[model samples]
Target: MEEKYRVLADTAVLAGEIMLKAGAETFRVEDTIRRILRTSGFEHCEAFVVTTGIMITLESSKAGTISLNRRVSSKSTNLGVIDQVNTISRQFCQGELDLSETFQQLKNLTPVRYPEWLTYLCMVLTAAFFTLILGGGPAECFVSAFNGLYFMISRILNRRLHLNDFVFNMFASFFMAFTCIAIQTLILPELLAEPAIAGSIMALLPGLAMTNGIRDTLEGDYMSGAARIIEAFVIAASLALGIGVGMECCRLLLQALV
Candidate 1:
């Protein structure tokens, strides 16, 4: 009985970890964990979830007590994984899957991401089209495509360097803005920096973070919601600061050259 309870606790924690890591809201994580635990016929089951961790406790006279803590250090947006986990949880709760089967399925679930080449092409096109949508001329569209290329290169370097998020965003936006200014000065004087810079950074915006923050807040997970919101704001501020610095340095450099 004790071993069975331990396995149940482990299963619940594993599911919660995967969902949380895949960027599910805190409230949703807690709900999913709670449902999985409740299916075990425990007298008392409690699940606590935050942005970074999960804790679950199960208690019954026969099992005495069982608990688990899972620390999730990293997270990314993978809605596909989230949906799969949710479906697994639902199946387990509905008796379509036993605990062991459900656990194994969740363990083996992998995220399906786009191919690297497609992702890069989309990034380049996204910037170019955004420039056109923002009323930029053909030159701005052309320069923004190169800016997008630089942005993708920056992402690849950051993966190897493992830089902090704020520092990475700052450096990326700085490089993009500075390059845009250089292109305008040397290659196409009529290229508009504003639209090009704006479009180039659109791919880096924290739109998903902001949306998840709002949803979490609406779901009554205030702490996680507030934390996510603050994170989004910090990223935005870093981008703005980098752009301002880059453009200012370009202005001074051009003045000196004249």
Candidate 2:
């Protein structure tokens, strides 16, 4: 029935919306929803819902490199239609739905927007690169950088604006950095001399945000993507701030020797 297809399409759209806003890919959601739908009795139906935020805005660079901003959000949905969509997706997640035949239907599925942890790792990696550029040896720099990054990212994700994220990273980074050094000291003493800067950097990459933003833009989901990009840049700035503070402290202490 035409009605059934509409319902199914709408359902797929909503699934995409939820995931996009939650930092997931449109195609990924579509595939999952479709998989769920196909396995359900409503497989023939196509449902769709246009999210308010999944819009993409493109910007072209001077070099003619085109970039886009992605954002995704839900506007409204039909309860009855949504309920059916929910049933299918839920069933699929629960393994109650059979989509063996529909598996290939999603080969081109957009990337599954990465979770926060992945984003954090990217930040750490970026930080490590910078730290290495700064005078810290490769091994030591990563040890300290990653230690700091882990505490910083973990606290930030689990606590957001809460004092926990802030204070935890502030203090935990130092501890984690030391822990990394200690571990290296015990297992790979060769790495003990690696700069704390490197360790701190490794601990800070926010890979997810960059990937999510790009993915969002590609899917014409600008709202979610822009928001994520802003967040990622903010995190990058914060890492820079931390490094600056550390450098300042070192400068002050080293002044006496000079």
Candidate 3:
């Protein structure tokens, strides 16, 4: 009994460490944990709040059978109880942490961080350039540009650049706004208005979030997915804010020219 419990705790600790290091995106971590616990027959569970996220601990001592103790602390905001259980099951069977990074690779949070604008510029350029290549109309291209720029920038910055989420978001929005202006300028005298509005805002689409959310929900992990869905909506709104500002700028400029 003591031996089994020790195994569970050690494996949980290792898995938690990997999730923190790799930025295991919430749902993946939770699922991994859930699997591990179920396999170990630790039926009861509770999570303790931690500054980074949650520390889930479980113990199940059924009848005369010894007992199983499962404990893990995860820093990721995304993983929920179900994921934790799954992780436990895998651990019980394999004696290895099943943790794998679902999002971008982890990076060291560093000094000498470039200004958000510079990071934003790189992101916008990546998106806008791709949009132009797709031969989208100026408006759609710009919309796609907004989508690509901010998200990719966020991904790189959040994942690789190791910046704060809010800081990255604000700059991504502003950069998207700035880049939209440039995009408007490069287009021929026509092809501006509705299409442009559509294009620039397309970056905020719920497609990615929706898919991930559904997967989590269907797997019986509701909490984490709900959080993800909320996050996606908030990000979409942020992109809209950028597109709106840029659209207003375009509108005003055209009015002056006329």
**TM-scores for all candidates?**
0.94, 0.42, 0.52
Model 3, span 119-234: residue lDDT tens:
66665665555556555555656565555555665666677767654455555655556555555565544544344444444444555566666766776667766765776777
Query: How many Å off is the CA of 102 in candidate 1?
Result: 1.2
**Using lDDT as the measure, which candidate wins?**
1
lDDT of 1 by residue, 38-108 (tens): 98898999998888899899988876888788899888889999999999999999999987898889888
lDDT of 2 by residue, 195-249 (tens): 5544464444456667766776787757656766775677666655555554455
Report the CA-based lDDT of candidate 3 relative to the real structure: 0.51
Predicted structure 2: clash tally: 56
Q: Sort the candidates on TM-score, descending order.
A: 1, 3, 2
**What's the ranking of the predictions by lDDT, best on top?**
1, 3, 2
Query: How far is each candidate from the true structure, as Cα RMSD in Å?
Result: 1.5, 12.8, 8.3
Candidate 3, which ten residues in sequence have the lowest lDDT sum?
A: 102-111
**CA deviation > 4 Å runs, candidate 1:** none
Minimum summed lDDT over a 10-residue window in model 1 is located at 1-10
